[model samples]
Target: MSRTPHTKTPETAPAGGKAPDPARRSDRSRRAILDAALALVGEVGYNKLTIEAIAARAGVGKQTIYRWWPSKAAVLLDASLALAGDAPTADGRTGLPDTGDLAADLKQVLRATVDEFNDPAYDAPLRALTAAGATDPELAARFTERLLAPQLALYEDRLRSARAVGQLAEGADLRLMTEMLLGPLTYRWLLRTAPLSHAFADALVDAVVATA
Candidate 1:
């Protein structure tokens, strides 16, 4: 799949409970490694991508990458999350939008998610992560923690708020509601059944409101 290299800045948190050396994190080198890793993995696949290959494309020493990340998964995870974060959901707020309108807030976030899915930069790495996670239990856990969990946490917060305001029925299961919103989106992306779009997101929000 032909795609542009991702240049969005990655979050600084390291995998495996360690911090990267500050000196190695200069803007140029960081973007180069991330772009190289994301592109190569999309081309050669996760099983075939190597630190040496990444370093060669990035024009940096293999030691430079290893000095920061423990493994190739760590580098790819960071790169994936960085490009994925470019989605400015949450009502354009830094977090989940708590604008007191539950349906609207959820729709906004879902639309942003759809947009991210459509972007080639975010699409390849995210697909790679999910495919790898299917076979690798440990990678699945780390991917959830470093990527998926934070987004789910936002949904949980919004749902809880809706319950407090009685937008949701009394004793509504928030976990299920979160899945209700996400499941269609995830299924569509996975199957390529159709283009993920704001129209679809709006429809989901409307369905939730009507059924609630």
Candidate 2:
């Protein structure tokens, strides 16, 4: 499928007569490329996605895509991150919800994640990415650094807050705590060992928090 991107006018010179920002000049095309990559992955599956197809769908030349991303995996990685958006937030803040009741907040977020994992639109594309990452060490490293680390940091931040309030042990390893809370859910989602549900999410939160 082809999409006609919205045309953007050139940026005006600054008050000091500086040239228009080079990065800003390409923002429109960048957005179009990312959006196209995301949509095509959802429709065609990541294995079938290609730079040529993405360039065509985004209305840009193939060389333009290669100029920014080395491979289709990199393009898909950026597209997935774009779709995930900024850190998980309820009030537009980066940290996870801290409602004093750490268990409840964790459950809420985990349940939402369960919902996302169960979504048809997200399920296939995510599975495709996971399969690719399993075999490609380079892509896997990029995925962990660019996508997984930020999410883990958010959870660690919340865990730190809980520890400060005496809810979590002062000596608790925040990084381990975050991983413990999320690891099972991720495993289940990726392996499809069982159905992902709010009940399972709540149980996982209770189990991890009890240990912490």
TM-score of each: 0.81, 0.79
Pairs in steric clash, model 1: none
What lDDT is obtained when candidate 2 is compared to the true structure? 0.81
- Tens digit per residue, CA lDDT, model 2, 14-96: 23337656456567788899888877877787678889999999999999899889989889888878766732432254668
Writing each residue's lDDT as its tens digit, candidate 1 over 97-170 gives 77888888888788888887887776776777778888999989988898788877778888888888888888
Best by TM-score: 1
TM-score attained by model 2: 0.79
Compute the lDDT of residue 93 as modeled in candidate 2: 41
Question: Where in model 2 is the C-alpha error above 4 Å?
Answer: 1-28, 42-47, 86-93
Candidate 1 Cα deviation (angstroms), residue 7: 32
